[model samples]
Target: MIPVLFLSTVLIWGTTWLAIALQAGPVPVLVSVFYRFALAGILFLFILAVTGRLRLPKREHQVWLVAQALCLFSLNFICFYHAVHYIPSGLESLIFSLSTIFNALNARIFYGERISGKVILASLLGISGLVLLFGRDILDADASGTLTGVGLAMLGTLFFSLGNMVSRRNSREGISPVFANAWAMSYGAIVLMLLIILTGTPLIAPPDATYLGALLYLAAIGSIVGFSTYLILVARIGSARAAYATVLFPIIALGLSTVFEGYVWHWTGFVGLGLALLGNIVIFAPSRRPRRTAPIAKDAETVASS
Candidate 1:
């Protein structure tokens, strides 16, 4: 099941950037985002409701849910959608690969986890990789588009990291990820709707088959199925292990970009990808601890139970 879920999520998400690119004509970014989440939210809610698995949040938990919706569903995606306009989808995915680093830092800050040397090293490696990956682009005077896209991708990854922290909170509070996600996605759609209304963005229907197909793929497979499986993987294997999938996403996205989008690659690009993946490996490697003496066994159980 783990393998199945992992592969499914990777395939679905690896292809989603192209779907998002296909959605880029005539319709506004916000509107396209709204459509994807709205359909997904509604369908997911209905499915959960029918299965008798829906869980309502308490007043206190509702606040966290709203925050999760904002970070995960609304703002992060908006940044990504706008970002794809300025850069290749593969490049955007490469930037998003930094989410693993961001997640660890946020965990340190929010949960008081000790900042490990590996985390610091991972950050530096990832940054160096980005510099090497965009080697000439960084020096080019006319590279505003790439720079801006990288900035947006970083901002979006930050939002995603924060959302992971929020999800951990929900998980700790005995809320199911699927339940929280279904509700949060619905809340996310409403938020996007309100933003559209406030900004007075023109509402438009899908203008062609490409737009409609992309919308369905994104709403159903990308948002609904992809997120559900990924979160479930987080629950089962722990986040550190589950993040292994994310390390491969950029690789697959790059393959697609090379084939479909005619993206060019160089030696620096290969080296940069190696460095970045190595950073993720270092960051997610299981921590080593001294074996506990027999005397501490009961105390360990007590702490875990408490």
Candidate 2:
């Protein structure tokens, strides 16, 4: 089950990056974003209602749900869509992959989770690998756009990590991930609509098939399916481990970029990819022995008596 969820997330999200790049021209970014969640939110609500799985969130859960919406569905995506304008989709994915490290640090701060030494080492290796992958791009004379893209991608990743914390909290409170996501996406769409109204970005749809197709794909496969499977992993495993999906997905994104976007791979890029994947392996490798449970004198005595 874990493997299924992990692979599904990687394939779905990996492909979504190119879809996001497709969403760029003609339609306003905010409007396109709103379109995605509005459609996805409607679909999720309809499915939940038909299945009798939709329920009103408790007042206590509502606040975190709103936070999740703002972080995960709203600002995070806005930053990413805009960032892709300044960078290649594959490079954008690599930056987003930093979310694994961000999730670990955020989990440590918010949930008192331990950051294992191996996790820390893996994060460093991953960062180094990314630096190698982007070293030439960074050294280019006209790299202000690249820097801006990196900054936006990092901000998006931070928001995503924050959202994971909220999701973790909601899971502990027994809120269904599907239900929470439905509401969160709805709220996020509402927020984006407000932004569009405020900024007066015209709510015009692009008549282009490519843009419309990508939007539908993002709404259905990317937002609804991808997020549900991922949050389930967060609930079943830990957020830090679940976020390791980011590490693996970039390889897929790069492969797609090579095929579709004419992405040229250097030997250094291959080495960097290997290092990044190695980092994931290091973080996920099983510990030698499980932590010991507390000694139970009564159980021991009962066993002896028997």
Candidate 3:
């Protein structure tokens, strides 16, 4: 079951990167994102309702839900969607692999949690890996698009980390993620709709068969089923082990990107990929606790003395 859950999540999420790539033509980023989340959000609500798990958040909690909607569903995706236009899907996924590091930092800032040195080390490795992978683009004066994409991807990961912070609070307050997610996604869609209206963007149907197929795949498989199975996987094997899926999925995304997008991989990029994955593994790897020796019991001492 764990293996199934794990494999399903990796495949679903990995392929979603390609789906996002396929969504590049015709539709505006905001509209495409709106379509993805709105469809998924509706299905999320339906599933929750059918399962008798639909619970609206309290008034106070609604603010957090809104914050989550903006961070996770709206702006977070806006960055990713925009970034994909400039970079390979696999590269973006590789950059996003830093969400674990971002989450740890955000938690420390928001909740006064202590960060371990291991996390710091992991951050260095991951960031260094990214530098190696993109150094040529950064050095090139003409690669403005690449730079923009990298910045957007980093920003998107930061937003994702912030959303995770909100989610942790919601979870602690006994709000089922399934329930909170339903409302957040609905709120996200509503917000996007409002944005569309305010910006006077035209509503267009999926312009091509590929676009339509990608949109539906992202909504149903990537958003709904992927999230559901991942949550269950986290519950069963624990978050640490489940997080291993993160490291695995980017490889799949990169493989697909190579086949579909004609992504060229320099030799250094492979080394960078290894370091980035290693860093994440280091972040989640179980810490070795020093075992304390037990003291001799008083009764045993007395018996020996006597």
Candidate 4:
């Protein structure tokens, strides 16, 4: 089951980057993202309504839900899309993968979760590998603008971590993850729409079939279906385990790059990919022994009485 979900996410996400690469012209990256989610949100809501699954979340859940939408659905894409303008997508993806470390840290800080030594060591190894893989890109003078773009991707990851926590909080209250996500996407779309209108960004008529095709793919497959699968995995396994998929998806992205963009991986990139994969494995591996459960001693008096 895990493998199925992981592979599905990897394939969908892997190919989606191609669609993103096709986006051209002065259409602000944010506007492109706005269109993706707004259209996706509407379609998702329509599906939900048709299936008798749509409804408003409680007022108390609204703020965090909206925050999740902004973080996961909106600004995250804005950051990544705009970042691609300056950075090689491969290098950008390497930076984006740091979300694993950020997620672990955030969980520890906010939830009092213990950070295991294995997890820390694995994360360090993976990061080091990524640095090696993209070291040239990182050091190149031509990549200066991309340095800031990488920073934005990191910020996007932080927002995504926040969104994860928000979703967890919602689930703890007995709201279904799917329900929360649907609402979050809706709110995210609304926020993006408002931003678009306020900025007076010209929504040019569909430029061509290529743009329309890309937009539809992003809206349906990327936003709605990909997210829905992720949420389901989160519910089925656990958040941290589900997040391990993040480890695999980037490799898939790299594979796609190689096939379509003529990406030629050096030895360093291979080493980096290996290290990152090992880190993911170590992070998600089950403990040697379940944390020992203390046995409850039976009272002699109670036994005698019985």
Candidate 5:
């Protein structure tokens, strides 16, 4: 079950980058984001209703749900869509991969979870690998634009990490991930709609098949299926471990970029990919410790003898 969820998340989210790239023209980016969650929210609600699985969150859960929506579904994507305008899709993905580190840090701060030395080492290796992969782009690109994109990507990653914390809290509260996600997505869509109205970004749909197709794919597979599985992983595993999916998915996204976006692969990029994958292994490698057994009491042993 764990392997299935992990691999499915990597494959689904990895491909979603190309779909997001296809979402680039005509329609407002914010509006496109709005449309995605709105449609996904509707679908999730309908399915839950039909299955009799929809749940109403308690008052306390409602607040966290709203915060989760803003962080995960709203501001994070808003930053990401804008960030990708200035960076290649692969670079954008590499930056987003930092979520593993962010998740560890945020989990420690919010949940008081101890960070293992291996996790920290893994994060360092991952960061170094990303630097190797995109170091040339950072040096060669327009300074202001590159900085803006990197900053936005980092900000988006932070929000994503914060959302994971909220998801952890929701899990502790015994809320089903699917139920929480449906409400969070609905709230996120509502927030985006209000933003569109306020910004006066015309809610016009693009006529191109590419854009519409990408939107549907993102809404159905990416937003609904991908997020549901991911949050479920968060519930089953720790958020820090679950977020390793981001670390792994970028490799797939980079591969797609090579095919579709003419991303030239350097030798260093291959080395970097290997190191990043190695980091994932290090982070998830199980710790070895002998299980302690309870010592039998003398009285209990004597009773058994009698």
Candidate 6:
């Protein structure tokens, strides 16, 4: 189940960036995001209804759920899609790899989880690699747009990290990840819809086939299925571990970008890739000590009988 969830996240997110890339022209970024989650929310709600799995949460949980949706479903994509126009998609993905670092820090902040030395060192390595990765571009070019892109990417990552924290909290409260994800998505869709209307952004109608295809991919595969699995992974594996998928999935996105978008890499990019992998290892490496098991006690059984 773990491996399957990991691979599913990688594949779905890997390809979805290309779909986002497709929406770049003739539409407001918010409109693109609005269309995506609105459709995705509807699809998820429909699936829940058909499967009889959708249940409304208690009133008290609504606020956190909405915040999760705004962070993950709305702002995360808004920042990312806009960022890519400034930074190369590969560089954006690399920036996104920092999400694991952000998630670890957020876990510390929200849950009082101890920050491991290994995790901090890993974050430094990853940041250094990113410096190397963007060395030429940053040094040679004005980089006004690119720097802005990097900033927005980081902002998007922060929102994603916050969402992870919320999901983790909800999980601890015994809420199913799916239930949390479903409601959050609905809230996000509503927010996006309001943004679209207020902005008066005219939605672009692509070729009938292409637009529909992109919508379906983003809505069903990318948003609903991919996000649901990711939430489950966060609940099960700890957000720090599950966020490793962000690091791996971008490799897939970078590959696709190279082939389809003619993204050429320099020596620095390879070095950055190595460092990113190392950082991922550091962040997720298991502790050395084995967990102790309780010894079976015969007296405990006697007490139970009594």
Instruction: Supply every candidate's count of residue pairs whose N, Cα or C atoms clash at under 3 angstroms.
Output: 0, 0, 0, 0, 0, 0
Model number with the top TM-score: 5
Give the better candidate number (2 or 3) by TM-score. Answer: 2
Q: TM-score of each candidate?
A: 0.82, 0.90, 0.83, 0.87, 0.92, 0.86
Residue 127 of candidate 2: its Cα lDDT?
Answer: 69
* Model 5 per-residue lDDT tens digits across residues 1-306: 998999999999989988987887788889999999999999989999999987777887889999999999999999999998787555777788889888988888999989989888888777778777776766666666888888899999999999999998998998888999999999999999999999999998766888889989999999999999999999998888898888888778778878988889899998888888888788878988875444457667878999
| lDDT, candidate 6, 237-301, per-residue tens | 87877887887776677678789977789998899878877876786677788645443466677
lDDT score of model 6?
A: 0.80
What RMSD does each model have against the real structure? Answer: 5.9, 3.5, 3.5, 4.0, 3.2, 5.1
- Residue-wise C-alpha lDDT for candidate 1, range 1-306, written one tens digit per residue: 977987887788878878887888888988998999999999999998899886677888999999989998999999998887787655676677677677666777887766568767876676567556656544542366878888898899899878878888888888888888898999999999999999999999999999899899999999988888887776666454455566566666667878997878999889987886787577667789888887699889989999
Model 4 spans with C-alpha error above 4 angstroms = 141-143, 236-238, 290-306
* Candidate scoring better on lDDT of 1 and 4: 1
Error of 5 at 260 (Å): 2.1
- Segments of candidate 6 deviating more than 4 angstroms: 125-142, 290-306
lDDT of 3 at 77: 91
The lDDT-based order of candidates, best leading, equals: 5, 2, 6, 1, 3, 4
- Identify the candidate with maximal lDDT: 5
Between candidates 4 and 6, the one scoring higher on lDDT is: 6
Q: Lowest summed-lDDT stretch of 10 residues in model 5? A: 290-299
As for candidate 3, its clashing pairs are none
Q: After superposition, how far is residue 187 of candidate 3 from its true place, in Å?
A: 0.7
* Candidate 6 or 1, higher lDDT: 6
lDDT of 2 by residue, 1-306 (tens): 988998899899889878887877778889999999999999999999999888888888888999999999999999988887787655676778788789889999999999888878887777677766666655652465888888888999999999999999998898878889999999999999999999999998766899889989999999999999999999998888898888777777778888998878998888888887888788778879864554577678889999
Q: Candidate 1: which stretches are off by over 4 Å? A: 1-7, 87-91, 119-148, 236-245, 276-306
lDDT of 3 by residue, 152-268 (tens): 999998887787777767777777667777888889999999999999988888988999899999998998888767656544543334544655677677678679767689998
RMSD to the native, candidate 5? Answer: 3.2
Query: What local lDDT does model 4 show for residue 299?
Result: 58
